[model samples]
Target chain A: MSGRHSKHDLETTPDDKLLRKLEAKWEDSPTRVLRWHKGLDVRGLDCNSAPGWDGDKDDGGALVAAHAEELSELQERLFADGRSGGSRSVLLVLQGLDTSGKGGIVRHVVGLVDPQGVQHRAFGVPTAEEASHGYLWRIRNALPRPGYIGVFDRSHYEQVLVVRVEGLEPEETWRAHYDEINAFEAEVAAAGTTIVKVALIVSKDEQKARLTERLERPDKYWKYNPGDLTTRARFGDYLDAYQELFEKTSTDVAPWHVVPADKKWYSRLAVTELLLGALRSLDLGWPPADFDVEEQQRLLAET
Target chain B: MSGRHSKHDLETTPDDKLLRKLEAKWEDSPTRVLRWHKGLDVRGLDCNSAPGWDGDKDDGGALVAAHAEELSELQERLFADGRSGGSRSVLLVLQGLDTSGKGGIVRHVVGLVDPQGVQHRAFGVPTAEEASHGYLWRIRNALPRPGYIGVFDRSHYEQVLVVRVEGLEPEETWRAHYDEINAFEAEVAAAGTTIVKVALIVSKDEQKARLTERLERPDKYWKYNPGDLTTRARFGDYLDAYQELFEKTSTDVAPWHVVPADKKWYSRLAVTELLLGALRSLDLGWPPADFDVEEQQRLLAET
Candidate 1:
C-alpha cells in the first residue's frame, strides 16, 4: 500500500485482470517516471517511454486484446447500474498532443460498448457562442448524464494547456484555469461521476512522423489541418506548460496519468486499464430486477 | 410518379431497398391517417392503420431483419462522410404517446451502428439550468456534430405538445411555439441536417393494453409511472393538439411522418427505412481521399 497504491495514485483498484496486468506493466505516472524537466532544465525523460512492455509492442497488444471482452462487459454494467438515477457515470478526459491517437482511443478502446451508453464529444476550438460563456460552460453541458460513459477526447483542460501556451487569454486569466479545472472536476465527481484523466505522452519525433504520414497518405489528408504545425513549432513551450499543468492540477480525487503513448498499443491498453479501474472501483452491478422475474417470465411466455 | 410519390408524401425517396419497402408500405403521415377530430366530425381516420404490410407483424420483422446488415453499413458511411467540416448529419425526431417504443427504436434500430457514430439523448423535463435558457438553447447544443446521427427521444416538439396541453405556459406563450418551432427546424435543415420527424400512432386501446402489461409484468415496472394515466385522460385534447401541431409545423424541408406503431415490428422497420432513406439522400461517400493513396500504401508497406 505504501509503495504501490500510495495516496498519490488515489484509491483506485483495477476492475479486472486485464486492467491489473496493464497497471503492473507500465510506469505509473510520468511525474515520477522520466524526470520531467524540474524548472526549465529540459533534460532527462525520454518521450518514447513504454515502461512495462519490455519494449515489446506485441505483448502490450495481446494484453489489451485479452481484456477486451471483460472491459466491454464492465462498461455495460457501469452504464446499466447508472440508470436508476444519480449521475452514476464515468467521464474519461483524454488530453494529448495532435496525432496522439485520441480518435483511435475512442474507436478501438471505448467503442466496445453499446452506443446507447455513451455520450462522447471531442472538444476543439470553442464556437463564438461557446466562447461567450466561461470556458467551462459548454463543458458543463457535455458532462455525462446518469448511467453513461462520457468521453471527452480533449476537455476543459485546454483552457489551461493550449490556452495558456498560445496566449489565447492574458497570462493572469490563463493562470486561473488550474483551480477552475480542479473545481470543475471535483463538482462533476461529487455528482456521481468517476473522473479519470489520461494524457497520451507522445514524443515530438512520433508526432513529426505522423504528420509526414498524413502528407504522404491520401486517406489521412482529411485529418491534416495546417494549424497542427503552429502548435508543433511551439512544442518546447507546450512541454513546459504541461509540466506546470501536472504540478498544479493533479489532485487526490482526480489524479492525472501521463501514459507513454509513443507506442499506440501500449497507451491504449494503459488507458483502458485506467478506465476499467475507475469503473471497478465503483463496484457496479446490474440494477436489481424491477419486478418478479419468475412471474414476468410466465407472463411473457403467455404473450 | 404523381400517385406513387405524391406531394403530400413530402418528396422523399429511400436511400436503399429496406427504406423503400418501409415507405411504400405505410401511410406517409399519421396526421392524415388518424381521424383527427377536425372540429366535431371525429370520423376521418383510425388510430391503427398499417397500410403496407397486410397488417402482418412477421412480414415487417422479416423485412427489418433482412436490411439490418445493409442499414448498419449505410449508417457507417453516413457517419464517415460527416467527419469533414460540414453539417451533413441526420436528426431523427420521435414523438409519440408513452410506450410507443422510442427506447426500442434507439436500441434495436440505431443500435446496429458503431456507437462512435451516434449522439442519442432522451429529453425529459428540463432541469433548472436548462429552464433558465430558451428551450432551444440546450437543444441547439445537443444537435449532433457533423458526421453523426442525432436521435432525440423526445424533442422540442414537447414544448408545444405537453407544455401546451398542461398549460405550463400561458395560452399566448404556448401558442407562439408553432412558428418558433417551424423557424427552428428550418434553420437546422438549411444548415445541412435533414430532419425526419415521426409521430408513432398508438390507439388509446393499445396504450391501455400496454399500460396494463406494465402493471402485470415485473420487468416493465421500471417503465411505468402513474402520471401516464393522467395524460391518457387528456387523449382527445392531445389528439387535437397534435392535429394543430401537424398543420402549423410540417413544412416541405422537414415534414412529419406518422406510422402505425401498434405493431412494434412494423414501426421499427418503417423507421429504419426512413433513416436509411435520409442517409441515402446525402449520397455520402468516404470523404474523397485527400492524399495520394498509392504512395501512402507504398510507404505503409515499407514501414
Candidate 2:
C-alpha cells in the first residue's frame, strides 16, 4: 500500500466520498497511483502488494460491495447519455498471464454495473479470418459503442507480447506494432472513448499454485490448457516483453495500470477504483428530459 | 398465485430443492404453470397477479436473492460444458410492450449470474442496412454461442407485433412471418439450445403509470419515446395482434411464457424461475478432468 495514506484514512472515506477523493488523486496524474511507467522493473514489483489500497481481503470485499450501487448508478448515467445523443464511451483493456486473475476481475469488478451497458470481448489466438486481416482490424471492430463500458479480456497487446515472445511474427513486424498500437489508442481516445489499459502481474510461484489447484479440481479442468505450461516455462521472457510494452505503449490518452494480482481480492478492488476514476473523469450528469414534460404528462393521463 | 401450491409449500422448499421441485412442475407441461394458451384472453389476465408464486414483494425479492448463488453455479457448469466441447446453450427471449418491466427483469434477475457467460442483445427499429436483409438474418447472427445464456430484449416477434400493427409491411408479408418464426425457433432448439421465450404482460393502466413515472424523472427521460405514446394509442389493436401471435407461433419447442409484469418484483421472480427451469433441464454436472490429475500436479510442482 502507498505510504501517503493509511488504512484508517480509507476506513473514514467510504462510498462516494472515497470515490471522489480517489478521483481527485487520479486527476493529479492518473498514472501516479498504480501505473507501470518507463524504466520500472516489472520482475521486481511485488505481485501481492496492493498499491494505494490499505486493507485486507475481507475489507476489500466489503469496499467493493459498497461501491456496487454507485457504480451501477454511474453506468446507467453513461448508458442514458449515450442514448441521448452522446458519443462518449469507456474501454477497459485487461492483459495478463494465465491465472493472473483476469476472469475474476471481470466477474467481481465489471459485474458491479448493469450488463446491458457492458460489451465484453476476450481475444485469444487469432482465427484464420482474423490472421488474414491487419492486426488492428478485429480490435477496431470490438471498440465500445457510444454510452457503453467495453471490457477486453486479453486484448491487442498480445500482438507485441505473445507474438514477440513466441516469434509468431517476424522481428520487424512485431517491433513496429508498439507505435501502431499507441496511435490506434490515441485515435480511439480522441473519438471520445476513455481507455484504461491494465496489466495484471502475478508471480510464477502463485501461478503454479493456481494451476495445481485447477488440475486438482475436476470442475476447473475446462479452464486449464496444456499450452499454459509452455507459457509458464517462458515467464521471464514474457515479463521482459511486458517491460518493453509499458515503456513504449503507455500514453497520456490511454495509460497502462499495472495491478498486482497475486491477491485476487486486492486486484478486483484496484480495478474497481481505476474504473471509478475513469467514469468520474467524464463528469456526466443525468440528461434533462428532451420532451415537454407537462404536455406528455397530460397526454399520458388522458390515455 | 396458484391454488395447487400454497405459500407454506413454497416456504418449505428453498434454493436447489425449490429449484428441483419447480423443475418437476415445469416438466409436467412446461406451460402448465405460466403458458398463454389459445383460449386465454390477453386483456382478462390479471397483470398484477403472481401466478404459481404465492408470495408478497418482499418474499419474492428474497427468493430471487436466495437463488442467485445456485443460478451462478449452474451457469458456470453450463459454460464449462460448452468450453469442454458441449454444444448445448440456452436462449432467453424477452418480448414486451413499452414500460412492461423488461429492463427490470434483466437488471434484477439475469444480473444474478456472471455476465461473461451471458450474451445480451437488444433489437429495436431496424436500421437501413437491417431493413434490407431478411428479418431473421440479424437474429441468426445474435444467437448465443455454445455454452451461453443469450438474452434478447425485443426479438423477432416484433416482426409480427409492431410491423402488423404499424402496417410496416404488406399483410401477406407480415402474416407469413409466424410460421417462419416457429420454423426458426424449432431449428434453433433442435440444435441443442433450450429456448425460454417470455412475454411480459403489463396492463394498459399499469403502463400509463410507468410511462408517467418515466416522464416525471429526468434520469429516466431517455427511456421515454414519443413513439411509445403512438403505440399505446393503438393498444387494443396490438393486443389483438399478440393474441393471434400466441395462437400461431407458440410451439412445443419454444413455448411462450406470459409473465404478469405489473408487479416488478413478481415479474422478476417469475422470469428467474423460468430461467432456472431452462438451465436445470440441461442437467449438467461438472466436466471431469480430461488429463491425468496426478501427472499434471507433478508437472505444476516442477514449474
Best by lDDT: 2
Candidate 1 scores a C-alpha RMSD against the true structure in Å of 9.9
lDDT of 1 by residue, B63-156 (tens): 6765665665566666656766556889988899887878778867876565677888889999999999999988898898788889998989
lDDT of 2 by residue, B1-303 (tens): 021232225465445575454434333433467877778878788998877765577777777776676688889989999988899999999998999988887887888888889899999888898889999989999999999999999999999999999999999999999989999999999998999989998999999988988887776888998888999999999888888898998898998888888888878878888898888789998888777778777777887
The prediction achieving the highest DockQ against the true structure is 2
At residue B97, give the lDDT of candidate 2: 94
Give the lDDT of residue A47 in candidate 1: 54
lDDT per residue as tens, model 2, A244-288: 899898898888898888999878888987897888788898888
| Chain A TM-score of prediction number 2 | 0.90
Q: Candidate 1's error at A87, in angstroms?
A: 4.5
Chain A fold similarity by TM-score, each prediction: 0.85, 0.90
